[model samples]
Target: MKQKRSRYIIGIDLGTTNSAIAYMDTRKNPTGGADAIRTFSVPQLVAEGEVKEREGLPSFLYLSTGQDLPVGSLDLAWAKERNFAVGEFARIQGAKVPGRLVSSAKSWLCHQGVDRKAPILPWGSDMEELSKCSPVDASALYMGHVRDAWNYLMAGSDPSDRFEEQDVILTVPASFDAVARELTLDAAGKAGITRITLVEEPQAAFYYWITDNEENWSGIVGPGKIILVCDIGGGTTDFTLIRVREGDAAPTPERIAVGEHLLLGGDNMDLALARLVESRILGEKENRLDSLRWLILASLCRNAKEKILSGGDVQQVGINLPGRGKGIVAGTLSDSINMEDIEQTVINGFLPDTRFDETPVRGRGSGICEWGLPFVADPVIPRHLAAFLKKHAAEQMDSSRADGRFPLRPDAIFFNGGVFTPRIIRKRISAMLSNWFSHDTDPAFQPLVLENNSPALAVARGATYYGMVRRGRGVRIVGGCARSYYVKVAENRAALEPGQITAACVIPRGMEEGEEMEIEAPEFKVL
Candidate 1:
């Protein structure tokens, strides 16, 4: 019997500690709103004792003395409760190398061979410590998640249904260089994702913001309007100047320029806070902060951070040390020195505007200088992004204002990314941008911004939108106005290695694949 083509579109947001997937609904077209981007965060993490069980059969798997019984997420979660799980619930803990565990998969994507090697952690784990698992290839590790995402979609889908044509659109940070983009696409392909288009995270966030506001991409974009997008995510923060021009077809939008800081994210902030906590509170007791323990503290500080920023002292919003049983701690944090402490933690740790043209923020190659986003900016990360964006922006924009690009500013800024949690980071982002653009002499340098519109999940949502647009299956905000050029695969190029660049292939003209136009050229292979 012949099989049918698959029609499923999978959107995945592979994050630091979590991963999620969403796609086009065969039953209902997700209204082109914030709601359209529905996803399952449970994709990357499975807690202990939470695995679904069948009524008649054994509820779990066994691998021990008598073939041990094991449940998925619940197993680890339960282990943590019972104190059986060690070093991050049986995962690696307290390793000097980020390579040991796949905590910063996206950051590793910035490297050559590393991007292909760093994404293998929860898939299989042993108590062998973090060092045994540390491999230099970040791309391979990342591929595991993409593969998992694809498998998840296939598993959840109806088996009796005929396979339908599905296209994939992957999202990544703006600072990603040619190598990173290639590696990301390669990873997607390895995971069974067929057709793909890489959209910058900030760009996807902008679409989400516009789609939410207008109900569709067509609503907000028409005639002459400027929409600036500033996406300060966990790993990287970027700014893009989008201009809606009414010259041809629909309101065509162009990406004028983009700015970002790689190392400035929530994680960066967390590290800073963690260190402070270690020095001021824990001090000599630092050794007690194991991986799992540190994770718990980071989680608590993150939870209370936003509340503290909002001028509210959290109720029961405090640290939890599993072994120590410190469930939660609270102080006169809101009214007293709490907010000040938090503010100082962020302001001082990040170095704000004062950090330009120096250290991680400056003189780095493409794709962010620091992987540490200010969200938890201690122990800084492998990538520092802001300086990368600013440098690129300076090169592309004429800050002198002599050229039309001089005013290079976005109309309305959109912020979304996996790292944009706790919501307080949004405020921190606005403050940073105020400093970034204020240094400019041009009157048009002002940027309009919005905060956390499903920050972590925006890319997955936009990917679904992009897939539909590409396949002509659903309506997207990319109505009459879209990129004038057709969505063509990169052209003839040599066989690309893990992170090598193969040229872009052009789609035949006149054949809009549900996008602006169809492939006009003969279907030629890119590899």
Candidate 2:
């Protein structure tokens, strides 16, 4: 007798700082129960000969010298030895030599000016002797590691349990442009993920919400209600607004708008803290931090910041700053992240409460600009939020949307990222949102209502559920691409005509992808 084929769904969260994989067996849960979803504990080396399993894989890669290690030192159970290291060991050890560490490759993928496929990562570093890789290559390495982990889990269990046989859902930032998305898809392809689909990270988070709430989701959310997903990862902050649409059976979620790509998040905060500590150390002296030492200190600041934010009841943290010598610790620099520091640095500086009409202010332009990642000059998060809402909620899009009202605001907010681990930041953002909502009515309403319990792993979980939904099992979010796409319309007019070159929107808001549209216009030379 022939054996029945096992069907499984895999979800991969390709994050900026950390990545994770989750899987579910449709064969086990034919009824589409959320409990079927389980996280895959990825096997990676935490230290030399100390292999351990972690829930999420740190999205980092370390170029190895291959001198001080034995054969198979960098090999996983399913993967052979490679010159580079990934996960915990890569993150922990790479901190000591940041020049070799390839971090924030996801951010680099979105940069337009740089050649993504070229080996230019570990950008602007003086690691000339060592080999460097492209952003796409870095992403593929992480995905390849996750793929190996999945295959390793199913190796002895079932012959048909290969990742190639399963449907995969890969999550990306909602703000990622077309090129970035394409690069991510290509990266997954290179990583041996055959059957895959790309879902926005914010949408994946909301899908997790749906799975978590289950039958109760319909009760909590109704038609016409908007939910804002605020995703602040290690490298970028993404905001996506999803509106609850009318449905016959259940309320369908439709993504209405996505925020601008802001290269400001936990990494920026870490850099700020590093600068603060550096100033304290130098005390306005002529001495400045060298590149290597500055890199090490930045890594330390990241670690210390995590401790201060997540470590409850821990008043202070200390870092043994390294000096210019072999195996030498200069001094133990201890500092407390006081409430005032948090307020002044993060709340006031990054997310200051602003009115709906307000927008982010541009700084003075410089003559000579540094060539690197494009960071947001203005740190005010509210102003960016306001701008996104205003831009998408314009009355012009009313013809394409179910709700015609301008200045649309979300009824609930979903927070996802390590930065939101502290209750203080969440509360501050909630207060700012409420202040914006207060302008509409006499009695103020709190718009930030939805709270995600598993902020760290929600994207992976939601993506797993999304894979199930793709197989016609669970509830599906209805919106396709969030933004309206347009093609430039060229007109045959005289010179100096302002309306000669216009744009014709080919894809309307909420239109599902792969839906073909025929545009009726005067045929000009296709540009």
Candidate 3:
């Protein structure tokens, strides 16, 4: 029996802080070009009883109490009688009530320390009798909301045009391990998206670049050029290196290395700014903020940071904190943050300029540490990049060196994620990289910046192009498994004595998809 092809190919970028959707209609452009892709504006609840369309849906969920809103205020166009909300309204209202909000669910989904399936989100909250959801459930709810939004706007009365019935591709971090990838698939399944494929977010960004410059991509990036994809989003920072190969007709890109999963990004910067604002508000007072108040202040700081870094004429944004008193207007606290605060806290503190040999500082660990997401101790992003380059130096070395001791130098850099949206931030990073390379290897070597049209939404659009590439329509980046698979084996020893355990590599790194290998090891006797 012959099966009918899907009408549309959809791409979903399930980011840590935001999510977006893009699709291509196969009937309109059968050959598939970058111009055929279209971004879908999601319709979500912006406020109580108010619905609005936004390009990116904030990845946040708010569990509403019985008295949170008026009757029938949480109703959407597709569904009614809702007790919870997921989208802009959730982010806005959840800021006030942090105990019931579920933010950074994507980061929690990949956290192996906690049970991802257990209802433990809103971590470290003291509100009792409050309904809670697992990380997997929160992620599923976000995806489910995206599916419903697409169906409501695009599907209409035609069942065949439903989002779930179309071909879909989802993007994940290149550094996500096997367990995290499995949980992402589980979340998608729970959202009723049965048929789907997973593409690394870094690869998707590169795909978008290729799609956007399909005509002169070869001229922009030629063979022997190594492009580094630096993706720093709200909750995670991902790095991937792609080397261009000399093909007969066109230049081919191959993924060389991927950095470790480092849970550091704009969220850390928000916390830093919050602390700065807190010091200003409480000025020399010993009285400290409770957990709930601290969370509220942090949310307000995030808003301020965004406004200041948005490259607008506004130099300062006012932040107000609700008082603990019975009256709403009495005892309210207020403060303002200017551009200097952002420069000192986010730019100088998080992304400071350092030498290429400098590495991230590791603080001494205590025996008993807090149980939560394992964020990087040192927040300096350039130091981490230096360390990553040092680790992967053996992969691609500078041929100019006689002894071949020089590190891998990137010919160009492609920046993605919301953190790089600010021009100052991008300029600082570019200057730092150029300084490092020019001082060490060549005097005139400068990395070319591959301009991205939409830094925040590139992953989703790139994922859509990747879907077309899967159908043998566009250029494909040859990236298989990012990491290698290993197994622990015990050395030959007496049964009474302890055996020496060693890690044995079963599958080498960069193993292509659908490739298989058989392990040849001696069987050990069970003691």
Model 2 spans > 4 angstroms off? 1-6, 68-72, 157-159, 325-340, 363-371, 396-406, 486-506, 518-527
Judged by whole-model lDDT over C-alpha atoms, candidate 3 comes out at 0.86
Local accuracy of candidate 2 as per-residue lDDT tens digits, 198-294? 9999899999999999888867878877888998988888998887888887678877778888877887777666666777776665655666667
Selected candidate, larger TM-score, 1 vs 2: 2
lDDT of 3 at 61: 93
> Which is the better candidate, 2 or 3, if ranked by TM-score?
3
lDDT per residue (tens digit) for residues 19-127 in model 1: 4455665445533334554563332222334333111110011112111224332233112322122223222221212222345555545535342444343223343
- Give the residue spans of candidate 1 off by over 4 A: 1-6, 26-46, 52-101, 112-165, 189-192, 215-226, 258-261, 282-337, 351-407, 418-425, 428-446, 450-452, 472-527
For residues 1-527, write the lDDT of model 3, one tens digit per residue.
73466889999999888999899999899988899999989999999999999998999998887687897898998989888899899999989898888898998878877999999977767778678899999999999998998899899899999989988999999989989999999999999997789999999999999999998887898888889999999888999999998877778999988998888888888878877877887776665566677778888988999999998997999999988644332367899889999999999998887888888888731111222677877789999898888898875675663234336778899999999999899899888888877744467767899999988779999999998987888988986788888877776456435545666787888887668977666554688
Candidate 3 weakest ten by summed lDDT: 364-373
lDDT of 3 at 147: 90
Clash list (residue pairs), candidate 3: none
Query: Is 2 or 3 the stronger prediction by lDDT?
Result: 3
Cα lDDT for residue 142, candidate 2: 92
lDDT order of candidates, best first?
Answer: 3, 2, 1
Higher lDDT: candidate 1 or 3?
A: 3
